[model samples]
Target: MDDPDSNAAQLASPSYRLPALDQDFLLGDSMRGVRFQLEFAKAEEVLRAWGIRTTLVVFGSARVREDGPGRHADWYAEARRFGKLASLRGGAMRDVGQVRDNVIATGGGPGIMEAANRGAADVGAPSIGFNITLPHEQEPNGWSTPGLTFRFHYFAMRKMHLAMRANGLVVFPGGFGTFDELFELLTLRQTDKAPPIPVVLVDETYWRTVIDFDAMVSHGLVSPSDLSLFRFADTAESAWQSLIDCCLKPHPPSDYVPVP
Candidate 1:
């Protein structure tokens, strides 16, 4: 026979807690796989609900600022302009469709990321910010749609989400972090691990100075054909055109016309 006090104690014990409610157990080392799945599923479910079918990912330096020194302002402005242009023409403005293509996606932090997100906000289009947990604690830019902003602890998981839905890639001048992401996608493209997608490097002069593709070819570090994987553009208009030339499909204007 169970005494009332003993029954109460048993019910309150940690061991008796439901698995889902046991934070200690759920966060333990053994549950890492479960945590990974949870991370993936949480974002996937929300994206599906929001009908984000394809994304135009923008990668750039977080150090750039609108009013900062030198070409930083130019880079920021172009990124913002590209974001708005892409949203306006890339089917992201369609209210009647169940799918949104070419929606602007960013790192969800400041600098170029904030500029792109702000561009989407300019025309009242929803954007995505895939933020990562960093030691310095990067915050999501205010321009990304509140419901679509997400933070992940694992860089691998964050990158997977970024790459999995990308329809095109627009890269701006950046340093180590940006190079990491740029090369990863380039490698995937070279190996055919990812489907062919348009890749545009904004500011041909900046990119040419930063990466010596010709030198790579001369050194046999990369094949001549590998250089064809991406193109260079000097402005937002040219960047969009480069994507179009490389077969980044945009929905017909009629499909995005608002229903009265």
Candidate 2:
């Protein structure tokens, strides 16, 4: 007869656990690559299931609130307006065939992200929020479609998801995080790694004050043509129009039935 203690010990052994059910094993350093792949696949699958074919990515400061000081109110209001305008005009309102294009996507936090998501909600359109885990926990804005909101621990994976299906990019005033996202996409465009998509920066005065693209050109830091990668707009309507001018083709009306 087998010893009961020995049998119990064997059953409780970590090695004997199923890999998929083993949290310690899954979260270990050796599984980092697997975690990255999981992050990519999970978001990809949900997005595909939702018929999100492409997105108009919005980047901005999470610090800007509608009631905040100075230009914050205007910026917030405009961002919200842009979200609604884009959704109404960009085929995100179409439920036919479950193929949504140019849906608004943001970082899934408060401030500008919340405003954009709220705008889409106001028009009864679904939007996406890609939240990330930070030292200070970031709560997802309530406006993003619950199923479409996601959280990622890996910045690279999050950035990958942001860039992969972008039809266009609209950047509002922001700080370091926003700049990181903006420049990454611009670099991709400049190097031909990403397809030429419309890039618009809202608030010409603010952008010019913050960065001297023309000076970069004169100093030979960047070629004169590189400055053409993005254009500036003072309002949400003009920003959208700039995208249209840059040949952002809105999805055409379709008669196909939604997938059940």
Highest-scoring model, TM-score: 2
Q: Write the per-residue lDDT of candidate 2 for residues 105-160, one digit (tens) a residue.
A: 99999988888888888888899999999999999999999999999999999999
**Residue 3 CA displacement from its true place in model 2, Å:** 3.0
Clashes by residue pair, model 1 = none
- Per-candidate Cα lDDT values, in order, are 0.91, 0.91
What would the per-residue lDDT of candidate 1 be over residues 1-260, giving only the tens digit for each residue?
A: 77766678778899999999999999999999999999999999998888899999999999999998999999999999988888988978767446889999999999999999999898888999999999998999899999999999999999999999999999999999999999999999999999999899999999999789999999999999999999999888899999999999986346454221
CA shift at 224, candidate 2, in angstroms? Answer: 0.4
TM-score of 2: 0.95
Quote each prediction's TM-score.
0.94, 0.95
Task: Give the lDDT of residue 66 in candidate 1.
Answer: 95
Candidate 2 deviant stretches above 4 angstroms? 1-6, 252-260
